[model samples]
Target: MMASARFLIPLGIFIAVAAFLFKGLSLDPKEVPSPLIGKAAPEFSLPLLNDFEAPFANGDMTGEVWLLNVFASWCGPCLDEHPIIVNFARSTAVPVVGFNYKDRPRAAKQWLNRHGDPYTQVVVDLNGRIGLDYGVYGVPETFLIDQQGIIRYKKIGPLTQMDVSQDIIPLIEELSQ
Candidate 1:
């Protein structure tokens, strides 16, 4: 009986671990849930990236559905997502608001110049305070906010063309109505 019990204990432990591993493998890492979903977006007032004279504020976008893309020139994923963002920006569906996280103004401007500037308004979060307030885990995170300024969804990684076509655009269309 003792020998049988010992074998079963190890077998049970192995099965449990394997179950957990399988569950984790099946989960998508990019589908991380944000607590801010369906909640009002955190308020922020930051200087514009190109024209510092005109400050940008979250309150100004209250009555419109928009996208807030958190990016930085130093983040490689931001580069990967730029063209998708540019295409989205050109669409009449929604305006793309940029949150430039903790990047040098000159480098950010240069990057935008090299790539296309896809933002309707680019706000500089030079110290990352706004990023922290928004619970930013990394750059290239994108938020979809509804007309009432509530965050509807958050995309944790670079925006892929498929993500835009399948998830983001559909959500924006639904929210706009």
Candidate 2:
């Protein structure tokens, strides 16, 4: 009985330690809500992906309910979410702006070209500086902005078709008014 108790005590301690480490290290998805929500988006003047002359800033986002989709070729989930974005673009009148996160320009362009781009404008965040300012923790993040250029909602993972139909579309409609 003493031998069994000795083994069990060590095993229990190991389990508790592992559980504490995991709980402390793991990321909580919902805890990181969009900081830009209810606030004006940070101003940036990023040069358009193939055009040095045509630059875009937060000023360009005026008067429309737009989507800022953060993605990268290195992220598998971003690839998974690409098709949903393409389909949503076709289905809605709202514009989506692409922030290609921390990826090579050639790869970013190729991925979009192969998968089909839904963005009206694509900006390259080569160092993820813009994403940092936006409080992004991962790729495939999406932000919904209102007509006055305030971020209204943020979706963390690959947005599903149901999410588009239910959560997103309704918010867009409401904000557009």
Candidate 3:
């Protein structure tokens, strides 16, 4: 009886761990929770894509709600998500800041020229330090910052039309008020 009890305990533990692993696998990777939500967004000052003469900074939007979109010329998902961003920007009063992540200035400029630039201001993040500060794990992440500069929402993957209409737009309306 004593020997059987020890064997059963290990088997039960293995089953529990397997159950947890299965549950984790079923969950969506894009829904990864951010620690920055409800916290103040990290401040950054970076060169503009159009005019690098004067840098654009997060502080410039101090009292307004805005969207920060992290993107790069080399990232395929950024290309997929660009059109959705362009349409969303037109429908809202909130400013959309494009964070150009870790791409050459000339390539980034040309990519924007080809794809159509939708940003209110495009900020260049040459080294990705600003992205690191914002806890960016991948390209095509987006953050919605409230009027007081607190991060209200963080979308880990590409923005979808349904995402903006269902999750983001309602939140923006709520935060704007």
Candidate 4:
């Protein structure tokens, strides 16, 4: 009976670990919850990519529902999400503000030129300090902010057409009211 009990204990432990691993594998990484949701977005003053002589601050966005897209020239996912952002910007539904994360101004400008600029205002975070303040795990994370400047939602990965049509546009319409 003792020998049988010992074998069963190890078998039970292995089964438990295997279950957890399987569960984790099925979960989407992009669905990870962010603590910043429903909270005020972090404030920062950074230079605009187009008008480097002038500084843009988060405070300027007060009384507006906006989308803040954290992107970098080097991030491949950012490129993938660029078109969706451009479509959003073109729609005039909500202003799209960009936080250029840890990238050179020249490269960012060139990339935008090539892909087309979607941002109404593009702020440069050369040192990534602003990104840190926003709890950014990586580039290409997007936040939807309400009129009060509170973060309403965070999309952690590249934006898809479905994400924009189903999630973002509907939320913007809801928030606008």
Candidate 5:
């Protein structure tokens, strides 16, 4: 009985610590309404992917309501959602910026070439440092930044047509004014 009690005590402590760590660590995907809403978007400066040229920074996106899309060449859903992004760019005044998370330069270039780049600017976050700053837990997440550089909305998964029509389009419309 004493041995069992001793084991139980340690096990209980371990479980408590594990729970605390998980809770304190970061966001869980099931939690929908992100806290970034109506807050200034996180600032980051990352190297541009095209031609390995000038840096694209958060400062560059200020004064505009923009979409920041986190994608990876290796992520399948990103490829699936690429065309929708293109259509959005073609039809709307809202600009899209791409965060190429954790992809090789060659793959990033090829992905853009084959799928068509819809972003006004593309930044390659090779080590995911920028993504970490942006509170990204996964690829294919998108944040809507308002004209004053505040993050107004966050979409956690692959953006669907309904998401575009119901959430994104409405947010863009509201911000455009």
Candidate 6:
């Protein structure tokens, strides 16, 4: 009887492990939940990409819903995401602040010129310190911050039109009210 109990316990544990693994595999990597959601965005002040003498601070955006799009000139995904961001920027009233992460100023500018600058303001995170503060997993990640400065949503990868339509627009409308 004791031997049968031991076998049953091991089988139960194996089943539990398998179930957890299967669930994890079914989860989307792009849907990673951010720890910053509902929390105030990390404070940062960085030089603008086009101008080094000027600074842009987190406190500068206190009265409106905004997007912080982390991108780099060297990042391939940023190239793919740029068009979507540009269209979204043009269609929306919400400000889009490009967070240029760990990139050369000249390269960023050239890239934007070749593509199109959709950002209302482009801040340079030359050292990636500000990106670290924002918990950037990779280039092309975006954060939606509410008017009060709380981070409402974090998209871990490049923004898709579907994401912009189904998630971003709705949240921005809701937050604006």
Model 4: colliding residue pairs: none
Candidate 6, superposed: residue stretches over 4 Å from native: 1-22, 29-31
User: Could you tally the backbone clashes for each prediction?
Assistant: 0, 0, 0, 0, 0, 0
Model 2, TM vs. native: 0.80
Span of ten consecutive residues with least summed lDDT in model 2: 27-36
Tens digit of lDDT per residue, candidate 6, span 2-91? 998988998999999999999999899767688999999999889998889999998999999999999999999999988999999999
Give me the overall lDDT of model 5: 0.86
Candidate 4 structure quality by residue, lDDT tens digits, 1-177: 999899899899999999999999999876768999989999889999989899999989999999999999999999988998998789865889999999999999999999999888999999998899898876799999998999998888898888888888898889887
User: What would the TM-scores of all predictions be?
Assistant: 0.86, 0.80, 0.85, 0.85, 0.80, 0.86
Q: Which lDDT tens digits does candidate 2 get at residues 77-158?
A: 9988888999989988888999888888888888888989899998877788888888888688998988888888888878
Report RMSD (Å) for each prediction in the order shown. 3.1, 5.9, 3.5, 3.5, 7.7, 3.2
Alpha-carbon deviation at 109 in model 1, angstroms: 0.6
Would you list the clashing residue pairs of candidate 2?
none
Name the top lDDT candidate.
6
Query: Stretches of candidate 5 above 4 Å error?
Result: 1-32
lDDT of 3 at 110: 93
TM-score of 6: 0.86
Lowest lDDT sum, 10 consecutive residues, model 6, at 26-35
> 63-146, model 1: which lDDT tens digit per residue?
898999999999999999999999988875588999999999999999999999989889999999899999998688999998
State the C-alpha lDDT per candidate: 0.91, 0.85, 0.91, 0.90, 0.86, 0.92
